[model samples]
Target: MTPSRRAVLAAGATAMAAPALAADPVSLARDERHWARVAALFDSPPPGVIQLENGQFGAMTRATRAAYEQKLARVNRETTLYTRRGALQDVQAVRAKAAAFLGVDVDEIAFTRGGTESMLVLIGGYSRLKPGNAVLYADLDYDSMQVGMESLARLRGVRVVRFALPEPATRQRLIDAYEQALKANPDVRMMLLTHLSHRTGLIPPVKEITALAKARGVDVLLDCGHALGQTEFSLRDMGVEFAGLNLHKWIGSPLGVGLVYIRRDRIRDIEISILAEPSDAIDARVHTGTVSYASVLTVADAFDAHAAIGPAAKARRLQFLRDRWAETLRDHPRIQVLTPPDPSLHAGITSFRITGQTSLGQALELKKTLFERHGIFTVERPGAAKGACIRVSPSFVNTVDHMDALVAALKEIAA
Candidate 1:
């Protein structure tokens, strides 16, 4: 059947009887049969090239996409009636679900368009910086987030301090750099921490870094857009007071669904972006005008599907895929794995550069060569001190055979 018709049939089936949850966690870990069943939940990508760029945007599962379409249809039919009568309650329900998923209080969560929007709201509205106060962000932070911080510095009249993460980073070395920066810039009032670097998939020691910042009287705005659904953790686990997350990335929610969290007591620290009724609630600080009600409402379905597979199981599968390819090419004479092999520091996303090819042109050309010559798709990320490198990010849908193909391509191209 065609994909549209299949989606309609799947929607009807789901409405009649809830689809079963993913296989049990233990079984999912040890049994390929169970993993294959979970993989079947997603629609296969286009036939020609292997898609290993899920970190940029993960396509929704068959169930999630169908549910989103059904919701959109319902909203279009009901029109303003649904918005007037039922939208607020529906949104509140999803907000509560999101809070529970993050182990945060319901009042602390606010939905935004996506990760970039969430970050912009927090960085632009934070109220504590002054003329001489400083803010810090590292090279590994997302490009949009780095821009937001720069805007914040201009608006708040605070100096912006930029730093580079250790080229070959370890958990301790990462913490030490942050601590040294904080100590050196005693006037720094806020720091932006990317829980997982998008450039090279570096998982920093967030809890440790948060603690270090807190001890020095600095507040940390965590950009967890890539961390939330990919790895297992909670708000309490990270000990953070403010954060921005993307459900569309790892949660596999429909595009345009993201969240911002402000601890109940810390709500006063962020200025309200939209002119609305005076309140201290987290939602008051976020002003995403006329968002897609359908996308926000369907987030509950994404949550349901994510929970079914379980975060622990998902983490294992992503790491396994990363390791499968990394280990295969580790000994290649011209290949250098940018992400550290330590499980604590890396996940599915990994980058590598050809020994002598480090320019942006080289990286882009390599990406094109992989797609045209080897039927593989990847992306180039800039700002690495060493040079630009191609990034590969695989999801649960990718298979061992896919990684084997990537390994084979690298072996021939890098040789």
Candidate 2:
């Protein structure tokens, strides 16, 4: 065989079935052999690039892509014949499945284009705030969410209070910070809490902070865009009445799929906007007009892949990949790891900055160097309260080797 063909064959051989499952996902996480097999389930990325910037969205597995294409073809073939007739029923079926996956009431969830759309729906329609009331958010909250809250200030005549969570924060310290903020801003009747900070990949203590907010009578509109599939948690347990979630990120679905969730009792708090059909169903809260039928329907297939590995395993596997590189480089003098070692405070996503290079331009340059010089893809996340950072998110498709490559590249660059 030709040399190139032999190399391709060798690579394909690693895609063999994962060995019998480990007793638990934590143990399974360190088993590179199992992850390599799992990685093979996803169609490969381009040959040369190591895709570590997975926070933006997830890659489709072969099975998911096939299912998506088939759904697409079916939707096209039937056109509005299916959409105008049986589509809502089909969507309801999918909604039931999504609700079960989230452990939420089916009536509480509504589909939207993606997490951003879901956020917009919740922020724009929040009906509880009145003039002179204050809405609080942190620096680590997602950018679009911050903007939404700012717009809410104008629309509702509420005061906007933005604070920065303590860098290098711990579970107790985080809660303390929120408690202090809530006490300091007495008029704060609403707040935004991001389950996972997209900028620094810091998973805050949502439950405890939500408790603090509740004691102060602050209604929380949570931005859970990156948390749903990235971490294993019961959304209800978080005690937030409102949230936005995405299927396209950690869930590995095709893009343009996400949902808005309001606890059943709180549904009345979000005013039914004109975009909706003026119905009481949660689905009527946000209508973007003609969503991609294929993207919505194929969530069933995505959930298949998600459940095959299971949420705990997927989360552990992702954190495993992250830990490998982050732990390795944490001690480097010139490198600063943003996510703390607190296992509860971090998961799949993490961010870091080269010492003293904390500006957006510097972060972009570092990202460019990693991409162009070493063929390792990473993304620069601006708006970190302390500094700009390069965010790294790994999917199940990534293995220890990809992380090792990133470590080696960063070490060389820092040197």
Candidate 3:
């Protein structure tokens, strides 16, 4: 075999030989030494920082980080081999693992750089939209997806209907608003639903909404960017035609890796906007040129990490922290909780606004002050509400003490 072909085969063998099992937690339970090792994988305190802004980016764990480091090092040694065919096998393995976790066939999932790219692919791929037809989204949708819709509207000369969720919405009211929008714009051929809104931390009843849209002949694209690792659900259960999820967030994978799901039958009909390399294959829409193989390969580690920890246990622990802290701040007169207090309506995220505050600058200052003075790090925003407020997202690694520290920071600032 040529040296290049031999190297390619070797890398493929290594990836296939990589263990799929979860890391041993006995080390975590038995020794304080392991805690520091695990903690080092995350952004360390004092310089790197605490990451309550996981809604923005959740860095990888020690296992996934090490896996990427090793893979990248190996790729550096065999660049030609990796660039040719090894990269393909690595990405396929990750995609297959992600599909298994998502409860879909391997062919149903597509690898994308991240959620934004995935959303662009979905919105731009549809051939149905024209001047009179509309794309339906809402106030709660992520800004990136919203921008994609607006840009498409501008470029395609179609109308983009952005709706609102009634303040302090009841479950039925939330569903009704979407239904009403669909009814009003009967010409709406597409709907972009955020399974979990980044700002409000609200999770819509996606299955119900998707079913309603399908019955009306509207194609639905669901964004699970904030929902995937944070909540428990099956993509098959939601029945949406297209969905995108960021693996880095709740799954704790390496950055720049995401999964896009296209319903099995619809793959051929959607044209990818991304220019792909020439290939005789199925679902060419996903084969965008020269993706990062190291990041893609770590997605499997993210899945393993998630499963090993136990989803139900992780969910309960995260939600517990949010609820415990949110309840304490809920009664503050100056605070207006944008997220519903009901646990069923949300997950790890809880966002609110300080009643009198204004500007993202003020919010940012508050976050910095809390970190500097009280040792709590969080995200602040001049959000789509009364005013600026801090947002907190705790992970499975966080403890009740973390919530207590946050509460203390709020009390100090509020006082």
Give the best candidate by lDDT: 2
Candidate 2 lands at a TM-score of: 0.94
Per-residue C-alpha lDDT of model 2 across residues 192-269, encoded as one tens digit per residue: 999998998899899999988999999888898999889988888888799999999999889989999999888888
- RMSD per candidate (Å) reads 3.1, 4.4, 6.2
Instruction: Identify the candidate with maximal TM-score.
Output: 2
Range of the 10 consecutive residues with the lowest summed lDDT in candidate 2: 13-22
Each model's TM-score? 0.93, 0.94, 0.85
List lDDT for all candidates, in order: 0.85, 0.86, 0.72
> Higher TM-score: candidate 2 or 3?
2
Q: What is the C-alpha lDDT profile of model 3 across 1-415, one tens digit per residue?
A: 3446434433432332222123333223322333333344444545434456667877665555666777777778898777686678777777777778888988887888888778777877766777888889887788888888888777778888887876676677778988999999998888899888787688878899899999999999899998888888888888877888888788887788787888878876567545665432325666566777777887776676566554654565567668777888888877666777767678889776666776788788888787787766777754454455678887644655667777776776777
TM-score, structure 3 vs. true: 0.85
Model 1, 330-391: lDDT tens digits are 77889988888888898788889888898999999999999999889999999877789899
How many clashes would you count in candidate 2? 0
Q: What does the lDDT read for residue 87 in candidate 3?
A: 78
